[model samples]
Target: MLGTLHAWQAVERGHDVVQLEREPEARGASVRNFGLVWVGGRAPGVELRTALRARRLWERIGERVPALGFRANGSLTVARTEAELAVAAEAAEAAEAGTERGYRLLDAAETKKLNPALQGDFRGALWCERDAAVEPRTAQPALREELAKTGRYAWRPGREVCHLTGTGVVDDRGERHDGDLVLFCTGAWTGGLVRELAGEPPVRKVRLQMAQTEPLAEKLTTSVADGDSFRYYPAYRGEALDALEKSQPQTETARAHRMQLLLVQRLDGSLTIGDTHEYDEPFAFDVTEDPYDHLESVAGALLGHPLPRIRRRWAGVYAQTTDPGRIVHRARVAGNAWLVTGPGGRGMTCAPAIAEDTAEELDL
Candidate 1:
């Protein structure tokens, strides 16, 4: 998405773009994500501002490409316990809740009224009207098709750039693509050329487990999140959250896997649910069942019934910058080349704005 968005930005600026992909198609964290334009959970300042801009850009781009499946359906983070409710209340009461994030504190009745499919026991929820969703699986192709209409974009798949030349990059096929500037938007695959160009950039890779279930009989009006999500996002950090954490510690399974329940209903009606974060390196080669079991139990509790049988399961790794102060690790690798990567989970949510920023910095 980062790379594609950069191409979008460049093409929008009347610059011709040639995008090279080593794989036949995208099969990375960019696709293996919740496709959430999540605005409510971003930290204040640059991160929040970037997300808000990306949200607007996504809506506009979606308008141009209908297949992106962009929908401003919003999201509800359900609070099951009183402590959790207190945390939600605190966030809803924040000064920027309404003005910036469109946050509303909804009681259990209001919550159920908004999303009837959440027919489970929960005290209340924090509603963020600014949140949105898109179809990650098809977003790139749809965007590429739209870009191609301009006759300024070229997508070369199944080609790997093996060397960086003064003009541009040389592919594995010994074909040298000449250009004035180069942007390496490598996601988690940071070895090889990235290391040779710039030695480590204070970034780490994160592994997560996620799954998709068979289509549900009913509609999930909006994206949903469990109260445990409070602990994962920066916007929820407060005294109330501190108390909630102390009072209602995560279950052993959740704590072990750093799990959180974020459920987004796909356009096809299937629920895409995840995920457990693993920060340690040398990640396991196989996905574990315990995390799936935990996800099923939590999802069932929220739905008031068992989730549709899980149709598929997979794990993905994404690069995250170790530096908390920066959104991504962007550095000039060479005079004509720059490496922008490590947006972590925010890649899908903020790619458009990030790419826009890159274009501005480079005066594209």
Candidate 2:
């Protein structure tokens, strides 16, 4: 989200910006996401602060780009088992103590008070009042439309860049685009783009699959995740926090075989739920409908009650790093050539603020 936002910001600031993509049409990972501009995780920490920045940026953009369905409904994380509740208690205490990302622990009565959709037993829930979500299908197009209006940018969606030479970029078509700067937002395909540039960092192409259930007529606006959700990433379990306290970077790979499921409800009354990750490293990126069943099965478990009906299913990919922090980097390759990428999965949440900051970065 940040890199794309930055690319557009660069365009707004009088720099000629050209965005390149590989698909004959622009669709996948970037658009096929929960559209969640969330700030509910590990409260008051760097992650929360960054999410808050992105969350606020979305708010600012929503002022004009109304299509960007940015909703500040907050986030609710439920604890099903006693062990999970204990962990939730720790997180809530940390949040209350002012960890930087403010997460409050609400008891079961309080949890159900706000969201009656919660059906199962839970000791308490983690409430992040600042988290928000946006439907990317609408938001991304609005952004592109706004970028188009700037007139300083050209969105070469069908063309994929083969490499870059100083201010010139060579596309797969054998054509080239030279400008004052070039930014990469290719998501999972960034490793190939990285090889074309200098200083190759460790990269993995991660595939995440998601689905939407039939609208329940009455919808819950907030997002939800559980113990199974905690296992999907180490940070939700506080291991990330503990590791960071010891000068260690917490890194986690979503166990593909475990069928970890996390669920969130969208504004249109449909249930947006998903995702198990498969890491196809060093020359692999695949999205298949076969994995849809895996995700649906987990969603069924996490929801505790039967999902009304599944209306759509799709697979998307993003770049993943050993250090779970987003893969966002901007460095000079040769002379004044600049390169930026590695958003991993949180791009949508972080992009708007990132773009604002990128817009402010003066050309040296």
Candidate 3:
């Protein structure tokens, strides 16, 4: 997404851009995410601004690339407890502190009206009408195809950059690709040439496990999240959240694994659910089924029905900054080369705006 955004921005400005990929196609964090353009969950300042800008950019780009499967279905963070409902109330009142996120505190009846499928026991939900989604499995390819039509963009797959040459890169094949300005948006991969050039720019890797279920017979209407998400996202932090934390601490297993339940329906009507965050290095080689089991229990409770049979499960890793407050770690690797990475889970939501910031700053 970063590469495609940069290439799209440069090509729109009438500059030629080339993107090099190490694999036949992107098969990393970019593709393995929920493809959520979440707005209400962002912290109130530059992060929110970037997310709002990116949200607009996504709609514009989606218009050009219909295959991206952009949908303005919005989101519902269901609040099962009174404390959770209090946090939602606070968020609804403070919506103007950031962008116009269209936040509304929905009672159980109204929540059901917005999403009829959520016919379960819940006090209310925090509705963010600006939240949206895309098809993660196909978004990159769709963007690349659209960029190819610009005639000023080139994509070189199966080219692993083995070394940096100041104004260009040398691939493993010993071929040199030169450019006036080079941007390395290398996702979670911080080894090899990146290590030799940047030497770990305050970024850490995070591993998560996620799964997809078989298609449901009904529509979810909007993306859904359990109240446990309040602990993971910054937007819900404050007195209400702190009180909730004190009163309703996460389960021992959930806290140990840093678990959160975010559920989003895919274009095919299947649900993509996850995940547990593991920040420690030397991540386990295998994913555990305990987290999946816990997720099913929580999701079933909210839906008041059994989930469809699980069809697939996988684990992924992405880079995040060691600094909790930083959005991404952008650094200059050479006179003409720059590295932009470590947007954490915000990568899918803020890539376009992040790339736009890069282009504007470097005058690309």
Candidate 4:
């Protein structure tokens, strides 16, 4: 996504851009995510602003590329406990006090009214009308196709960059693609070329497991989230959240695995759900059923019905900066070569803004 955004921005500026992909297509964290352009959970200031800008960029880009499947469906973080409800209320107040986050604390009735698919017991929900989604499975291909039409963009796939040339990079194919500048948006594969140029980057890899269910009988009008999300997002921090944390802590397994329930309905009516965060290296190659079971139970309780049969299950890994303060680890690898990565789960949410920042900094 970063590479695509950079290329798009460069092309828009009347500059020729070449995007080289290690795989035939992007098959990394960019595609493995829930495709959520989540805005409500971002940190209160700079992060939130970046997210909002990216949200608008996504909508604009989606308009140009219909196949992106962008939807301004909004989101609801359902609270099932009193503590959770307090946190939601506080978040609503915070949203009102801050920027136009479009946050509203919805009662249980209102929550159900907005999303009829949610039929279970819940105190209320935090409604963020600015939240949206895109079809990650097709977003890149769609964007690349649109960029190609500009006549200034070129995509070279199946080229694993192995060495950095003074001007550009040399791929494993032993071909050197020359360009005035080079940006490495390598998602999770941070070794080899990246390490050689950047030197033991201050980034850590994170692993997660996710699954998708068969098409549902009814529509989930908006994306859905469980109270567990409050613990994971920074925006929910405050007196109320602190109180909730002290009164009602996460379950043992959830805390151990860093679990959160982020559910979004696909354009095909199927529900995409996940996920558990694993920060430690030597990540288990095998996907465990425990996290999936927990997610299923939580989602089922909120929906007031059993989830449709899960159609697919998988695990993925992405790089995250060890320094939480930095959104991404953007550094000049060489005089004209740059490496921009480590947006973590925010990759899909803030790719455009990140690339924009990169472009501005490099005067691209």
Instruction: For residues 312-343, write the lDDT of model 4, one tens digit per residue.
Output: 99999998888877888899889989889889
C-alpha displacement of 176 in model 2, angstroms? Answer: 4.2
C-alpha-based local distance difference test score of model 1: 0.94
Clashing pairs in 4: none
lDDT of 4: 0.91
Kindly give the stretch of ten consecutive residues in candidate 2 with the minimal lDDT sum: 248-257
Root-mean-square deviation per candidate: 0.7, 4.9, 1.3, 1.1
Cα TM-score per model:
0.99, 0.82, 0.97, 0.98
Candidate 2, 276-361: lDDT as tens digits: 66664442344455456655544454455677788887777776555555435555564646555555666778777656655566
* Weakest ten-residue segment in model 4 by summed lDDT: 92-101
Which lDDT tens digits does candidate 1 get at residues 1-364? Answer: 9999999999999999999987889899999999999999999889999999999999999999999999999999999999999999999999888999999999999998999999888899999999999999999999999999999999998888899999999998999888889999989988889899999878999999999999998899989999989999999999999999899999999999999999999999999999999999899999999999998998888889999999999999999988998888899999999999999989999999999999999999
Which candidate ranks first by lDDT, i.e. highest? 1
Query: What's the ranking of the predictions by TM-score, best on top?
Result: 1, 4, 3, 2
Write down the worst ten-residue block by lDDT for model 3.
93-102
In Å, residue 44's CA in model 2 sits off its true spot by 6.8
Query: What overall lDDT, based on C-alpha atoms, would model 2 receive against the true structure?
Result: 0.65
